[model samples]
Target: MKINILIPVRALHDGKRRLSPALSATERRALTGWFFTRTVAVARSVLPASDIILVSAAPDLLAYGQEAGLHIVAEAHPGDLNTALRLGAAAARRKGADATLCLSCDLPFLERNDLEAMIATARPGAVTIAPDRSGIGTNAMLTAPIGAIPFLYGQNSFTAHSAAAKAAGLIQTTLRRRGFACDIDLPADLDSIGFMKNDRHIIAAE
Candidate 1:
């Protein structure tokens, strides 16, 4: 099946504000760049860059995505996360995608295998979700037929997505892997891992 990996990104300057308590503004921005770049790297390892789309309203991020040879979908300005993701899904559909995996960009510990597992979980009428460590947030999800259910991403989004998929009559699967569970949103999340960055990958050391 033709698949696309759509990653929604916020403006780097305003991306990791919740971590301000432990990281300076500059550090937070750098961290945001690091997280997004690493997430894309992992995706590239799973699929060709041509099939990966970076969805954002940020011009800077779009430029970066273009430089990385990834398809760029311009999200509506002042849009919410769900809206941007929906737009990305639509774009993927227009490109003839049979399934699209919506992935969050802050997954610091994410690996190529985590992405592979999510893709493997997808079926003709199935939705697979990888919940965050708290099991309240959706870190990664692959949906067959793109818009079978609304994009529900926010507080307690895992529950929202579960109900939506069930209502849509799609078989649901939840993947619980350490790589998918670890996203660097708060200071505590950042403190849980060690990051070593090089030209290619962000190696996370426990």
Candidate 2:
């Protein structure tokens, strides 16, 4: 399958609000930037660079993504997360992508093999949803034919997406891979990243 990976990035300067208790605004931006850089690198390992699309409202990030040789989609301002992902999927389909996987930007532990395995589960007219550690939010989702079902990405999105897929009569799979499960959103998420807590070197990577 000609799959494209769509990564929706919030503006670097206004991300990770949940981490405010533990991280200063500047530190949150820095951490998000670091996460994006590594996420893109890991994505490239599983798919060709051309198959990765970055969707964001930040002009700076869009410019950087273009410069880095990844497809860039300009998300409309005031839109929700699902809207950005829908725009990204549309953009990918326009570029001849047979399927698209929407990935969150906070997965610090994502690896190539895990992503590859997730993509392998996707077939034409299928939907694959990966839940976050809480099992309520959706960490990653794949829809073939690019837009098989309406994007249901928000609170309790894992259940919403599954219901949508079932309603659409599309094949659905729920994958609970470790790398995809551990998206860093809260203070507890930071504590869960064992290696990052012990190794300042990795956390401070620029």
The TM-scores of all predictions, comma-separated, are 0.92, 0.93
Model 2 residue 175 CA deviation in Å: 0.8
Query: What would you estimate as the lDDT of candidate 2?
Result: 0.86
Write candidate 2's Cα lDDT for 1-206 as tens digits: 89999999888888899988877676787888888888998998888788899999999888988987899888768478888888888889899989999888888879988898898898987898889988999989989877789888878899999998999899999999998999888887788786353355434533
Q: What lDDT is reached at residue 59 by model 2?
A: 92
Task: Name the regions of candidate 2 deviating beyond 4 angstroms.
Answer: 76-78, 195-199, 202-206
Tell me the spans in candidate 1 whose CA falls farther than 4 Å from its real position.
194-206
Which candidate comes out best when scored by TM-score?
Answer: 2
Q: Note the Cα lDDT for every prediction shown.
A: 0.86, 0.86
lDDT of 1 by residue, 10-104 (tens): 99888878988877776777778878888889999999998998999899999989999999998768488898888888889998999999988
For candidate 2, what is the total of clashing residue pairs? 0
